[model samples]
Target: MGISVTHKKLKVELVGFRLSTPKHYKIDGVENIDIERYDHEIFSKYLSILLEQENVEIKKKIDNCSITLLDYSENEISSYAFGKLLVFKSGKRQRIVNEDDLTEGEFKNRDQGLKNEIHFVINKTTGVILVERDYEKIFKASLLNSFFYHNKNFIYDYVDEFNKLNYNKETKTSIEIHKNKLIYINPLPSQDLFDELEEFARIKRFKVTKKVEKKKNHGIDGCAKELEDILNKASNTSLGQNVVSIEYYMDERGKGLEMDSLKKMIQNIYQSHYYEDFIITGTNIDNDLKTLTKDNITKRFEFKIPVDIDGNYVDICILFDKLLFLIQEYIEEHFDLDDYYSDKVRNLIVNP
Candidate 1:
């Protein structure tokens, strides 16, 4: 028999973040520590606290998992760390049958272990942390928090231009087309007026007629005091019952919102008039959501590295070497590290 090995590529995503030091932290005369000052000792101390037994146990949907830093390296410009994540599942009883021998055996009561890996690099000069996208989720559970607490002298500010999508600050214009608009009766007519209308209708056998006496001008503004009593009665009551359908157009291309403030606004406008959808053609709604993409951003901060699939035993050292090589080549060829880092620093100062 011959043996065959298969290799698959796992795409690794790299993200960037800038460092900050909160203004209040300066009250005690403490300044943000430069990343270049983060030598082996400082990083080791932070990692030690992050890897504490209690800190490593993270809760997942189906099982409890532990993450441990397995290997690491550091240089003047960058620092790297790789870790293993193991998920522990309680064993369930299993039945094994031998068809040829007509015998059966039961196995139970053991723990099954599943594993994954996470790795990241910190660019000292840029204050950017590069990490794998999927692994980034695991770090969020506790490791990243603990790391930040232990290293409080510096704060991580997500300054990537694409990250603007997170704060809902992009400009956009919305065009709303209203249907079946209803006129609100001002002054709501008086009780005596209603009684007279009822009597007149009854005498006329409820036939539609223009001969009935009508109320005077009574503009909505002049009748505001009389309508105040009914405002509460009319609130949130399917305000848009007459709206057959709603269509929207954005100045910029984007996806339709299934459930959001817009839908709530529509309902309010239709039912209680709690909100109003104005038809302002040729105007921008500041901070309205605009989709973010590589095409829209000034520069891309993330890069992808494809790795070979090797089950739970992928070598961290080799992976680290590959990442370093790719990053170095990328910097040499296309990336302007200093320029990008300066831009992120400026953005952080402005937004912070």
Candidate 2:
């Protein structure tokens, strides 16, 4: 990447120095001595000598360009010695520049003007430099390849795997549909597939009703009052005992309601003069029916088709007592019920 405008200029401090000496000159107190000269070649040679003697590491390089060095601090050197050497080699006539002079905008622009220019920024604490390169073309090429491969194989592989699993025989389960309700008998449907079915029903203008049963252990009066409250709210009017529906979420073992409770509710509904019909609906009917028959409770009602909001079947049990009278009209209008049922069963078996 190209260096940003803000990073074009670099600032460094002269922290140490080394000297080039005649092999036979036995000198004392030579560490603080200042020398003078005035040529680019001489300056470069003297700087190179200091770098070599101090064992400084070349922290950054930019080809026939700038180089920076870092010396071990324990070597005992001073910045004045290095400056003196620079003054001696470059030329006594050259004026000394302050460290702040290195930060001029003109100097930074000059360094950044060339195309494909590289730069480095060093962390003073660690003596490590960050090397920046101009590699826009290379980065763009690799990015294009990544986008193409991800869009092609990555998506297709997932779809293929999903289809294979959907068709596996061991995972298939049949769906049963009755009236407006759909029932899954064997394997349970996954949440994603169920959501799709719900969406389909929503598009078809169907309303879904879910019957939830509140568990009642001993407070029959409280349960009955609560049920009355729910019915009143749903209908926007007070519902008397007789106008209520008693439903249960049944399992294979039995009806979810106790026999005495069911009887008491039914009796209350029949005695109340505020309503006419008292119907009881249950899911998982096989078990419920077995339990009801064992207990000899024989009240019967027509079953309503239970569908999701999208007009898709969710569960098929007994409908409301009113549906039995409308069955003939319903069948007359929907001639493709058999085909629709078949499709639902096939989809459930494959996707569930």
Candidate 3:
């Protein structure tokens, strides 16, 4: 919840904007401001006021946080297109690529396969800031874009590091031998549950051939069950009960998700990727999310959106107090999937 550095530039984009006429309420600051009227002056002034409040809260959170507004001309906002490379702590800086870097293939936010692509939006009713794009796709691609394909474990490496900050238990490497020969080779310093499990499976001769990896999709078990089956083949070895498994972390219907704020301090703990999606819903959902320990907010932005699916309207309330847990959970599920093709399903990666 503590802050160090904050974002300086603010981007206003209307790329995927769809502003339908308000049916029930009128916009403030400008009299009778409706979708039909489309008063740019009144809307701009209202947005400035919101930003001013955010700036005040940001200054209070960080001693010397600085923020500046981007003055985009009318034409610029209309045809908004650019790279959004970013660098997190311990993360490599992403670079902007020329048009030649693009290829034909399907991937999340396949926005020309660019590493960094940022998009922002505002909610009409609540004035909350929102994003429709996959912030996670661009963020991960920024760190480790695939020349041919991606590895789910690549992103999990960073997510595991972040989970360490809260997980009280510490892990150290242990070497187990049978007879005089090396029967097991569970090794290394991290002792990350998944890492150890992956190696443990390998030690039991669970060979995950690269061919199976290229498959488009698998069950929640992914190739993990295949590894499990291989491990079962070697009765000489037994996996620890606590070993991480390739089980679906979220439910098939995504019933146990919530949202809250964790702020920039999360960067210090889990300096890898930031995913912005909202799948948690139900009454007082925001309150359920904030109940986690050591939660805090230290950013100047908001996201609001209404989703209409099958004629049902759903509103997402996000206050990101502790999100690394959710991110870790998603990574666990992704472990069973092809790194290149595991779509986040209803994970609704939202950014606010």
lDDT of 3 by residue, 1-352 (tens): 9876432332221112112211112122222212211112223332333344433232111111122222212233431211212211212333444456664443333122323233333322222222223333222211211210122222333333423432333332111111111011111112132222222111111112212222233321332322443233322321222222221122345443211111222222222111111111122322322111111111122233333432222422221211222223333443333421342211211111
Give, for candidate 1, the lowest lDDT window spanning 10 residues.
204-213
For model 1, name the residue pairs that clash: 238-271, 239-270, 239-271, 240-270, 240-271
Residue 69, candidate 1: C-alpha displacement in angstroms? 4.2
How many residue pairs clash in each candidate at the backbone level? 5, 14, 19
Could you tell me every candidate's TM-score relative to the true structure?
A: 0.33, 0.14, 0.17
Reference-based lDDT, each prediction? 0.32, 0.25, 0.24
Tens-place lDDT per residue, model 2, 1-352, is 8974322222111111111111111123122211110112222332334355432232222222222323212112321111111000111133334566654332323323222322222222111112222222111111211222222322333334434543435534212111111111111112322222222211101111212123332222333342453343232222243222333333345424343444444344332222212234333322221111101221111232445554333432222122223323333443344543453223422221
Q: Write the candidate numbers in order of decreasing lDDT.
A: 1, 2, 3
Leading candidate by lDDT: 1
- Model 1 Cα shift for residue 306 (angstroms): 9.9
lDDT (Cα) of model 2: 0.25
